[model samples]
Target: MLVRQCKSNFLGWIVPLLLLSITVHTAALAQCSPGAIICETFGTGTRGQLPQGQTNFSYRAIPCPNDGEYNVMDTVASSCHGDAWHRVTEDHTAGDVRGNMFVVNASYQPSEFFSQKAEGLCPGVTYEFSMWVMNINKVLQPGPCDEFSLRNPIIAMRIEQTDGTLIREVVQPAVPRTTTPVWVQLTMQFAIQTNVNDVVVKLINKGLGGCGNDLAIDDIGFRPVHPTLTIQFPNSTATETTVCADTRLTLSVGAATGYPNPVYSWQQSQDNVNWTAVPGSGQATYTINPVRAGRTYYRLRNAQPINANAVGRSQCSAESNVLIVNGRPDAPFSIGDDLALCEGTSQVLRAPEPLPAGTTIQWSDQSTNRQLTVDAPGNYWLETNLNGCTYRDTINVAIQNCHLEDIYVPDAFSPNSDTVNDKLVVMHPGTFTAYSFRVYDRWGSVLFVSKQADTHWDGTFQGQPCLQGVYAWTVDYSVLNGQNQERHFARSGRVLLVR
Candidate 1:
């Protein structure tokens, strides 16, 4: 294999440099990777309102908050010693006033300071949850709260459902006490394994307060992180090459680690726009047979399943760069090319219409005909005997599945959290080559978007519960046609979001 496997090093800064928007620290979230969307920026200002419905603590308009209370603030206040403590002057967002950040004093017991629910999210995708936080407590020499006695800031972040079904969790254990404020980012990436479209996030403070358990946070975001894939040739980094006909070549694929389990499929194409999968070519390495005299393209496709036990889909899949192989034949003769066909479909291969007298033709199948209809994929040769001379030509007929399929959707669903039709699921046979689903409000606001055929809607938008009414849904998908071709389809309908 020419390509080396990409690995994730959570302990190093390189991973963040590759996957996160912030490269200043060991941030793990897919911060600014492609398709990343910020769920919350808090707000912008020297001091902004404490985010409503996002945190459980009481909002106090003070630079320093009391136990079970928090406020978004800028600037600072004197410490217990009446002296200015190690305080942050601004927020975490760059180029802006560092503006304001979440300032909190640890509660007596564990409590969630931030809670949010996101719905209509796509399925089978690896999403990264991240936030910038800092331990704002300062240790003054000859002070009451010594390093040994002061408790460090600690917190737990998790994703769950309304029914309290735990999906995943990441614990900071403890944010080390610092003399000066240092903003660091913490991130966690995981896959959505089920059809449930509602994902709830909670950040709980577990530190005990009295002296030195204080923290500030900013730039909380959630986004998708897909593996980077590449194809390589042995002893070469070139993506395109010219070789003689009948030349054998070996290619390998490599991808970054993070996704649960990813499926690999090798594809071939004459024009880069249209691709056809090579039958049984689902491995890290693929061997190309003797090249035919023509220009051909090859690439790798990667699809990660929702979890280890699930099948992968193309909606959130990754495609590799194309590798062009131009074949130069020692003996050049043009037999032309056969147009691709759908599986179980037919194509007629006709010989020259104005044939010379005394001309006879025999196909590879031993059938004598001027034209033959092929329904399957393989090589077909035609031998023409005319003027006491014979000529032979071959054609490789491509056949694949390109059938358009539909998804089953209900006219309405109840999201009362009663677990009975609580979501509107876009049901399909799970065989689509590509798929996308979306739900929209009457005013043209998008409520949900799904990448998998089995995704659903939880009747919520932006952490706010939606009212009972009719909502529109649209679906676009592609299925296998003959010759591994993709047959595209689209559908739309209205459904009631009953409370």
Candidate 2:
């Protein structure tokens, strides 16, 4: 049974004798939330149709267990919604004990045979059929009487009218049984009419001959099909397009339509298959914000319009163009490189794209020096006001800001239990590849050493606490500056280890 949004909370009905046209308002549809459990169980006796059976039709009653395991089977036999049937014990033999119903391997197959006997039958109504089968396990292996040979066993159902005419017959797929002697259920569905009073529901095993394996059956019902709407976007093919990088793109739906007023949403996927909705894309004609400069595909999704109070499933549309962005210039242009003097100086800027022969070129940094002085840190770039089209490129410049940067220390300290800045710490910030710090007492005795400068001495030497006094410190280091050039420095100093 299909689920749809209705004005009321619960709508349960047996289909009427008239085939009524259903009108779906797109505005009343909504997306079904995750993890919803829906069940449509037509009552017993209204299930399973009558296939073309030449002989007897029978049903048996069964016993309910008291193990208190009120799970699917337990609850089904005992609860209000528990409409499942049990096996009849009175028809059991020595091997087929009481409370066991068996379906033998006769002419049982899937979707092949059907029976119809219409003494009371109708049109335009819906019906449901359910059956119970259990293993008697009377015999051992595969034979004419063994249910295990019941390969591809299916049930075929049909409804016949008074004039020997076939009204409706539903052939359901067959089920395979295991060696375990448990009960299994089969269900079938059909649409019927109201004038039908003495309509027949047939249960025939297709494929398996009359002497097929054995199982039992019971309880059927007739119920109504729920209100649902399905929509599709016709003749739409996924396409790909190429555009320049970082360019905003607009995608349009091509040759597609929906039943309900369709709401549009846009989704993107880098790879052609997996797609996700773009943020803030809950409207039609979506605009890509700061469009990415790459080959990205987008899809258009259509949703069923939702009414203020309706809640149901929303249908989806197909994907759209795969757009690409291309950059300009086609290749990287070069500018002439020149060196500056005085150690920390910088060279004037130049544009690789040729300029007028007499144009005055200004050095970047606003310095009139067509050349930069060797002193500080900064970046350089150039621009020329030619042809009204501004062309520019920037080269980064860095200066050595930290120079007296070698390790230094004080020589005396008092560890007489007073607190102040009392430890020797090697400190500097930026990137470092490797470094070592060493501290020596008056006699040139190595008191502490560390590869990591952050590790400071708290008046401790070689696991034993040392007395606070004067300490000599020395450090060696190498640095890679912002330009990725390496330099080395070594320095010695005195540190007052105070306490």
Candidate 3:
């Protein structure tokens, strides 16, 4: 192995020095690594498995690199507090190291990458492992894990045989060994395996002296894992699983491993133990038409195994969460329409038959997170989105509640069309929706009826201006509390017609 040191001009400056650090931290929720392998690779900011409120280095790989790949890990120290350390003290930094090969420290665990299989070496073909090493913080130990008893960074690189056994371990000098932050590189030469059906080299984090130390890794890779196969399939999942027998199943691919343009096949089974390919389509879905009366199983089958030569291969299949196939409930027990309420009223979209206490009612809203509350009027749907035959349903929302705020009308009104309260508008103290208002003379002749109070009366009826007098009006409206039922209220009031 050869040693290469890459340094910045601002060595002792904590703030500017820390700016050169490179990190790779990922989790199942983070960016998908090459070959669709999941890893906890976090970046300078808090993301995925990376710690919060702190910066750490991290990265991932689809498979272990035959030569070597980068490693992501974290470490902490208290004494020297800065981005880069000029003198050994205390402070934590996350980064990676490179050389002929590297190994993880005994204290911090780093992510690893391996090759699908080792290949025979050609003439003049020597395996080379190098990492763009960045020691975020170089500090001497103050306490427990921070104490660097064993001069080693939290990284280790090793090559494995086709059968997944270690053949050789690549060694590198302790990263951050110097008080000053620098990229002290190491390199080694290895003969490619001849009988090597496959090779898997990995970079990992070992507990460095059983104390807290951190580092970040990026661009961990093997340039020639596969000459022909350049892409892989990403992990796939279903937007929703358990559904009615006739319901359509939607599957989604999260991350793919090894090469793009890979093929996909969907399989179905009456019992999860047995599976049959869904005909006519290789998409991520399998709609079980003429569904049976019980639960069904579905899985994603790849055209080729992720590790073509690995033991048990990558058999990707997850059982359906579960769905019920009970026919629609008897009569009105399931069929019905609903009314809408104020934007803040609860509406019962579905009313299932009485069940034992604690019988969980599942809905499409996955609303299990909180109690179902209908605070407005709109189209709403709910279903058990499970794998049971009888666990699904949809519903509509319509509210018919009108409320009045109970307003006072002055005895005198200036039939003036001023923008501010120019007309005799209806007022109420409370709120309501879908309301109706009507006014009548002493003779009971309906003079005006309005659905909304955009503009009140102009002291005229049927274009024949009426003299100033007292008019009676009635308001009818409904209120939707948090229940399916609506409350109706009726009130009469007097308003004086003014000139």
* Per-candidate local distance difference test: 0.66, 0.42, 0.41
What is the model-wide C-alpha lDDT for candidate 2?
0.42
TM-score, candidate 1, is: 0.45
Off by over 4 Å in 3: 1-124, 144-151, 178-180, 206-210, 221-499
Q: Higher TM-score: candidate 1 or 2?
A: 1
- The 10-residue segment with the lowest total lDDT in model 3: 10-19
Better of 2 and 3 by lDDT: 2
RMSD of candidates 1 onward, in order: 30.9, 22.8, 25.4
lDDT of 1 by residue, 1-499 (tens): 0111111101101101112233235322332334434434445554445445867778888766777777766555655325535645556655444455678877776778777666655566666756677777775443464335667677876667757888766567577655566777766666665576666767787777666667877666555566677887777789888776665788887443323357677888998978888877777788887776689999876776443222232335666778888876433233468656876779888776565566678888899977788888889887766444456779898865453475689999999889999988877653888889899999978989989766778888887889999999889888874456778899999998877
- C-alpha lDDT of candidate 1 relative to the true structure: 0.66
Query: How well is each residue in 340-434 modelled by candidate 2, as lDDT tens digits?
Result: 33345544444454455433344466543344343444556554433332334455555443443444454655544456545555666555567
